[model samples]
Target: MRRRFKLATLTAALCLLLVSLSGCGQSLAQKDILQLDRHSNEITWGVKADTKLFGLMDVRDNQIKGFDVDMAKHITKHILGTKGQAKFIQVTSQSRIPLLKNGNIDAIIATMTITPERAKIVDFSNSYFDAGQSLLVPNGSDIKNVRDLNKPGMTVLGVVGANSVQNIKKYAPKARVLELQDYAQALTSLKAGQGQALTTDNGILYGMAVQNPGFKVVGGTFTKEPYGVAVNKGQRPFVREINKAIKEMQADGEYNALIKKWFGNVPGFNYKELER
Candidate 1:
């Protein structure tokens, strides 16, 4: 009788453990993200709150406003309708991926570039904005282009977790690269003369130049930096919906309108080239 009781207790405990494991698995399973957003009527986005044109924090009401924010709003409407809410969460270059992976945000649209490495962990939608790696320097600095940075003793400023930093190493193998926390810090370091040139996407540099008349983007663009909307690893449905929305926006000239709205006034940047 005693043995039977012990066996029965053990079996029950084992059953409970299996049940708990199954529940946890279900919780972690790939969800239909599109349907989830529709049901909730909201899509939370991780965006940069410091990068000027792509995503910037407007001090007026402490709200983030930029091209990325507007794009996310339009995408939310396409996914969940006009009534759906688009919630923005501020993210830095280092925090965006971790936030997305931990489910803190539904998607990331913070001027993130799609790369073979990033695609392994997070799925990216079709390229929404075409950008390219370039250099931002003081108005009369001698650094004219990437080739000039190839010389020894040149210090290049870059934002941490940015692909631009990685690309710079290829173009300027002899120059030392200093990675800052974000665009704000990088630009500050440049102003303080800590680095010779700040490197990033041209669109972002153009925005910075617009704000700081003393700085300018030079060297044209050495490498393509196509921006994309990122979702979790298994969210193909959500990616497809975003791609569809982009196609619709482009076909109806909404995409071009947004391009003009943000980049039209940027000095020296050919915004028309971006219009689709």
Candidate 2:
């Protein structure tokens, strides 16, 4: 009888071990996504603090504000309950993904494009916003559209991680491409006459035009750039939560309100096109 009792005790411990392992089978990102409400009820989102309209730091209060800011807060509340807290971390195009991978940030909503190349490493929520590539040039320049940028001497300024330079080459093979550190630098270079034109999403270009009087977005859009919220690869739970929150926002009219709040007043942009 004592031998049988010992065997039963061993079996019980093995069963307990299996149960514990099963509960912890999830990765950190997955576990965090699942216990969003219980585990501190706080989420840190990576966003652009320099890119205007999408996400930028408001100097007055030293807080990041813009379309991405509002969306992150909205989604955080939706997923983690109304009392959920969202901490914002500024990340650039070159650094956002790495930060997400290293567990520094929970998700990326910094106007990032949902490209297949990016998908191999990170999981992206459904396209939350639709955008397109366009050009910003000094007012009255000879370059009127994408077709006019094919000259051999025409230099196009782009940001480091932006795919605009590649698309620009496809659209204007003869044009020279100059990559800068960020959009602000790219715009500064364009204003300094380093490049004939700056290329990025039209929404970003519009923000630049608002800040600089003599530059305008021209050539319409050459490529669709659908913005998405991204999380680490294998974080399907996190991605699904984001997608669900986005749909909820759309159905509840919150998405339209946000679009109207930011893009509504943007000059040369048709905000109606962004309505849900």
Candidate 3:
């Protein structure tokens, strides 16, 4: 009887703990947001510092800089004003959701594709950038597109936690896939000849091509990847604020200017297509 009572008590305590944790994750109110932004004058954003053009660390200043970084800055200013602070935390594809769910990040502005699966877990703002999946291969390679990858022994590379890893198999059932932690690692493996082709959104592939010559993006596109800013699920107030900021940027031509600043001179990429 005593042992049974002890076990029951432990179970009750566990339940209470879980309930408290669940409530702690409840949606944030507008006032709470204002307090955080005003009290701290800073917002925490998750970003990818290893992915070039989207978010990469600049050696010169040892600071993260890219399209996502710029957008995060502009959004922070919109939310917190010129003196508002924006703190960026490096997050990989696999780590982003967990970090956001744990409250380590207030928002995610990484080159993350908005998908139904992710939407179920976190609220996402409207599509801020449009992209499509494609293949990046070394120059003079015979593999022209994804269809060509559907052959015995052909290997495709993708970033872990990215939908592309699973989506690639839909088009090339016979090909094998290898997932790395980030875009930089995927490209390094590609150059090392570990895989026949690297698969990701064309915009990212183009960025990779710029840094590493002799590699070209082929196979126009296989999937539509709409990039969105993500926040913890049920944060409707925060989501609305982000959407408003994005729209404001578009109205002022800041959106187009940012697109040009990052992707303007890349060969084989048409910046006009991204103009607001």
Looking at model 3, report the run of 10 residues with the lowest lDDT sum. 25-34
Whole-model lDDT values for every prediction = 0.92, 0.89, 0.90
Better of 2 and 3 by TM-score: 3
Candidate 1 residue pairs in backbone clash: none
Positional deviation of 189 in candidate 1, in angstroms?
0.5
Model 3, CA-based lDDT: 0.90
Instruction: Report the C-alpha lDDT of model 2 over 1-276, residue by residue, as the tens digit.
Output: 999999999999999999888666545545555465348788899999888898888899999999999999999999888999999999988899989887888889998999999999988999999999999999989888999989888899998888777899899999999999888889889989999999999998999898898989998898999999998877787778889999999999999999999999988899999989
Candidate 2 regions exceeding 4 Å error are 1-31, 36-38
The parts of candidate 3 lying over 4 Å away from their true place are 1-35
Ranking, lDDT, top scorer first: 1, 3, 2
Clashes of each: 0, 0, 0
Residue lDDT tens for model 3, 131-247: 999999999899888999999999999999999888899999999999998888898899999999999889888988998899999989889999999987657877888899999
List the pairs of residues colliding in candidate 2.
none
Candidate 1: worst 10 consecutive residues by lDDT?
24-33
